[model samples]
Every structure is written in C-alpha cells, then in structure tokens.
Target: MEITFLGTGAATALPLPFCNCPLCCKARTSGGKDIRKRSSMAVNDDLLVDLGPDTASAAYLYGFPLEQVQYCLQTHSHSDHFDPAHLITRLPEYASAGVVPMKVCGSSLTLKHMSEGVFREDEGTDMLSPEGMQKLSIQIHQAFPYSTFSAGRYRITTLPCGHDPGDGSMVYCIQDGNSTLLYATDTTSFSQEIWDFLISYEFHFTAVVMDHTYGSGINGEGHLNQDQFIEQLRIMRKNGIAGEQTLVFATHISHEGNSTHSDMEREHAAHGYAPAYDGLSIRI
Candidate 1:
C-alpha cells in the first residue's frame, strides 16, 4: 500500500493567518516541512481520507493523481475535513469533464451533515437524495462502527472516534492485499470497547497514522497530546497490533504547543513514531 499525506496540520492548520506566535513565526521563517495544510491523505492514488479544503491544492502541489480518486472515507463533517465546495464542482453544471464517480463512506450523521454543507453551498442541493447524488456523480454509503465493507479493491473497517459525538466521527482500518493501515485522527484515546474489538479481530497493522493534535503537556479536548499519543502507541504495541515493522506517524498536527516540523521529528523519533508533514509518502 502506498500512502501519501496530502496535508498533516490540524483544524486551524499551521501558523494561524493572523497570529505571530513563536511557532507560527518560526514556521513562516522555516518554510519546508513547517508549512502544512489541513489534514488529509491519499492511498495508492485511488482512495482519499478527508476531502478537506486543501485536498485539491495539496494534491496538485505534490503531483498526486487526484483525478484517479474513486473513494473517500470521511471521518466527520467538520469544515476543515469535508469541504462541500470541492464536492460541488463534480456537478455537471461546473463544466468539469470526465469526472470519476466518487463513493463516500461515513457515519450516517456525518453524511447528513455533509449533505447539509452541499445544500448550503449550492442552495438546496440535497446530496442525501438519489437525484442529488446522481447529479454530483457521487454515492454515499453509510458506514457503521465495527462493520467491515469493501470499496473497490480495498476492505475497510469503521471504528468510532471519540471526538465529535454529534457528527459520529470515525477512524478507519483499511486493507489492500497484504498491507493494512490504521488511519486514526480527530480522536482522543481509544475507548475500552474499541480496544476489545481490535483484540478480538486480531488486527495487526502495517502502518499507523494517528492523531497528535496538541503538543507535549498541552490539554486539548477531543484530541491527543504527545503524552496521550505515546500511551496509545504503547498499548498498541503491547497488544501486538503494531509490530516492530509498523510505520507509525503522528498527524493532524497543530501549532498549539507543537514546535517546528524538524524539531517535532527529532523529539518524536525516539518514541517509535515521527510527525508527518504535507506531501510525505510511504509504501508498506
């Protein structure tokens, strides 16, 4: 499996537009990996996680074949994650040519919120309706927690994210051939139920891209800080879910207490995981 991080920043992205804090100022001075877009990822050029506001721009900048994307797994309907403006462009009225039909999978509430976003953008385009979905060249598949389903050649299992309870946010376990990935973001620590499910399912991951929304010692509700992130990794390792070869990466970063990308990489490298930056790609 080929994984590409289109963007790796948290909800507000790195370097708030109007703020000039130390981290933000340093990010401005140190361009390269410090520059980040909203959180999003692409798998093997075919599947996308989170159609965020910067998805198109990030893909274009990184030379990813965005046109080949056939499936999208939405974690939630947060504006930073699911931008209806991008989805609206698939409508024939936009003169978008040769658009591939997209299959979007998410919790029912998430899907409903996304549809409402589309309605807000296009003025009454109800993406929940069959006619509306056909016009947009998209299919909405409601994914329930703990259920596995197939999308094209990949098998996906939905896992609840203890983030936005109202939106029914979810993480994902995606498998393609012999490679398996755990895409966990916009989440706090896993619940006991989730741990039991993972144990019972005998899931061993090839790679793990997990949430690190806050930096060390920083408290952020509905997100993981460095300490919490490491604890989760410890549990995964103890349970045999993440073996020695598992490529672990921290994503959905923010400028809260987080330092520059290089600094973070150096700090986290000893913890069995590294911070992912925009355009970073790996093969498992």
Candidate 2:
C-alpha cells in the first residue's frame, strides 16, 4: 500500500498567511519542510482522507492523478477538513464521467454538510454550470462511534476521536490483509473505549498518523497535550499496538503548537516517532 502525505499542518495550516506570530515568522525564515498545507492524505491511489483547500497543490506536488481516486474518507465538516467547493471541481473539467461517482464515506455530520451544502445545491451554486453540477456517484456511509465497513480490498473501521461532540468525529482503522494503519487526526487522546480497542486488537501496524495539535497546551479538552500524547504512545507500545517496524507519525500542527519542522521532529523523536510534513510519502 502507498500512503502519500498531502498536507499535515493544523486547521489553519503552518504559516497562517498574514501573521507575524513567532511560529509563522520562523516558518517564513525557514521555508521548505517548515511549510505545511492543510491536513489530508492519499491512500493507495484509490482512497483519500479529508479534502482540504490545498488539494490541487498537493496532488500536483505528489503527481497524483486526481481523477483516479475512487473513495474519499472524511473525518468531519470543518472547512479545513472537507472543502466541498474544491471537491466539486471533480465533476466536470477535472474529471469526466469515469471519475464522477466515487464513494465518500464519513460521519453523518460530515455527509450531511456535504450533501446539503454541496450536492443538494441548498444555495450559491450559480458558478457551477449544470454540466459541472452533475449528480455524482457519491456513497455516504455512517462513521459514527465504532462503525465498520468495507469497499473492495480495504476494510474500514471508524474509532472515536475527541474533537467535536455535537457533530462528532472519528479516526479510521484502514486495513488490507495483514497490514493495518490507524489514521488518527483531528483527535486528542483516545477515549477509554477507543484505548481499549487499540489494546484488544493486536494487529501489527504499518503506521500511525497521529494528531499532535496541542503540542504543549494544558489539557485543552478534546485535544491532546504533549505529555498525555506521549503517555498514550507509551501505552500503545505496551499493548502491542505497534511492532518494532511500526512507523509512528505526529501531524496536525497548530500555530500555537508551532516550532521549526525539524525541531518538532526532534521533540517526537524522544517518543520514538517522527513529525509529518507536506509531501512525505509512506509505503507499507
């Protein structure tokens, strides 16, 4: 399986455009890996996670054939996570009929926001002509707490992720045969049940894409502070959630959680993991 890191920054991405915050300033001074887009990933040229604003750039940089994606897995309705406007571009010019109806799986909130705000044309769709607004072959699946489903060769299991409560959010357990990967983002520490699930399932992991949003914040509610995140990693190891070859990655960096990309990598190195930057690719 091939996992492509499209973007790995937090909601606002790395350097928040016009800001002089210490992190942003340092990012400007130290360009390259320090630069981050939004949070998203492309899996095996078929499935994807989140559809952020920078999809075009990410695809271009990684040489992804945008029309080739057959499934899209969403985590929530955050503008940074699921941008329908950008997704709709796949309807016409960007993709022909062969690419129109790819399945989109996510929570009810994630699906509802896209259907009502986008597919239904609830309002403001004048720009997309009838041809551009062709009804897509989108399949919305329920990604509630601990729901599992399958599509073709992959098995998907949604786990609880602490981020939004009213709308809810999820982390994905994606597997193909012996290889399983935990796609965790827009999350803090796992809930007790989720922690138990990780312990109960002794599958060896190809990788763990984690949410490192709070960096060093005090228990920021629904978000993981650095200390707690490290503790959880320790537990994951103790419970056989990872093997000696399992790759642990930290992602979703916030402006407040800012540091030079390398500096951040060094911090996670202490936990035996590495930080994610835009365009990094992982194969498992």
Candidate 3:
C-alpha cells in the first residue's frame, strides 16, 4: 500500500497569511518542506482521507491523480478537514471525461452537510437536483463508530475521536491485504472506551499518522502535543497495536508550534516519529 500526504499543515497552514512569527517567517523565507497546506492524504490512489480547501491546488502541485480516488473518508465536519465546495467540482460537467463517481463516507452530520451544499448554491438557491447528482454518480455513506466497512481492497473500521464534543470525530483503521494503516488526526488522547476498542483489534499497523496540532506543548483540549502523542503511542505499543516496525508520522501542524521539520525529526527520531510535510509519500 502507498500513502501520499497531500497536505500536512493545520487549518491556518504553516505560514499564516498575515503572521510574522519566527516559524512563520522562516517558513516563508525558506521554501521546500517548510511550506504546507491543510491536512489531507490519499492511499494507493483509491481512498482519500480528507477534502481540505487546498486539495485541488495540492493535488495539482503534487501530481495526485484525483480522478482515481474512489472513496473519500471524512473525519469530521471541521472546515479544515471537510471542504464541500471543492468536492462539487467532481460533477461530470467539471471533471475529466469518463470520471467515475466517488464514494464518500463520514458521520451522518458530515454527509448531510455535504449533500446540502451540493444541492444548493452559496446563495441557497436550488442548484442541483437528485437526478443531477445521480447523473454525476456520487454516493454518500454514513459511517458509524466501531463499525466496519469496505472500500475497494481496504477493510476500514471507525474509531471515535476526542475532537468536537457534539458528534465527536472519526478516526480510521484501514487494512489492505497484509498491511494496515491508522489515520488518526484532529484528536486528542483517546478515551478509555476507544482504547479498549483499539486493544481488541490484534492487527499491527504499518503506519500511523497522528494528530500534532500542538508540537511540544498542550495549547488546548481536543488535540495532542508531541509529549501526549508519544504517551499515546506507548499505550498502543503496550496493546500490541504498534511495534518497532510501525512507521509513525505526525501531521496537522500549526505554524505556532515553533519547530521546524529538521528540528522535529532530530527530536523525535529516537521514538521513530517523523513530522510529515506536504507531498510526503510512504510505501508499505
């Protein structure tokens, strides 16, 4: 299985549009990996994990085959992670000739919001009818926590996350053949119930992309810092969900985190953690 990180920064991105903080300034001056877009990833060119506002530009820049993505898994309703406006372009009129419909799975709220957006224009007028969406050939599935679903060669299970108090968030564990990947982001430490659910599963993950909204310090709830992330990884190890061979990566970074890519790599190398950058690709 191959995983491609389309974007790695948090909602504000690495260099906030109008900020002059040290990290932001450095990212602005130093190009390359220092620059990042909103968080999103594609697996094996078939499954997309998020549809951030930057998806289109990032896909063009990184040469992502957006037409090949068959499934889009939304973690939550957060604007940074779910961008319905961009997804509307997938309609047959705007997409490449003969592009297939993309199956999208998320919580009920997420799907509802996306459907509402696709059916109406920004001004709230009726833009597209059900027949139009049918012609466009889009499918929306509501995913339930702890339930399993299949998308292509992947068997996916959803885990509730500690983000958003109302409906919470969904974290995905996708297994294809011999390899498994845990995509966990926009979340803080797991709850005991979620921890138990994870421990019940015996498969080891090939790679895990964790939440890193806060780099080294805890700025708020519903997000993990570097220290908290390591602690959670330790628990996963104890539960046999991860081991020495599991490739660990951190994403959804903020500019205010105050750590550069090289600095985070050096600091986290001992723990087998790598700070993910936009366009980073891994094969498992």
TM-score for all models, in order of appearance: 0.99, 0.89, 0.93
Highest lDDT: give the candidate number. Answer: 1
The reply for model 1, stretches above 4 Å from the true place, is none
lDDT of 2: 0.76
lDDT for each of the candidates? 0.93, 0.76, 0.81
Clashing pairs in 1: none
Model 3 TM-score on a 0 to 1 scale: 0.93
lDDT of 2 by residue, 1-284 (tens): 78888998887788989989888998999888988899898888888888777876899998876667777888887878877777656555445466546677878776666665565433444222443335454555666678778967899888867788655688898998867888888886777888787667655578888887776765566666677678778877887888678898887877775578889778788878888888888787
- Distance (Å) between predicted and true CA of 11, model 1? 0.8
Model 1 local distance difference test score: 0.93
Candidate 1 vs candidate 3: the lDDT winner is 1
- After the best TM-score superposition of candidate 1, give how far the Cα of residue 101 lies from its true spot, in angstroms: 0.8
Candidate 2: worst 10 consecutive residues by lDDT? 124-133
TM-score of 1: 0.99
- Residue lDDT tens for model 3, 145-234: 899989888899998887874654788999998899999988889899988887776758889899888867657678888888889899
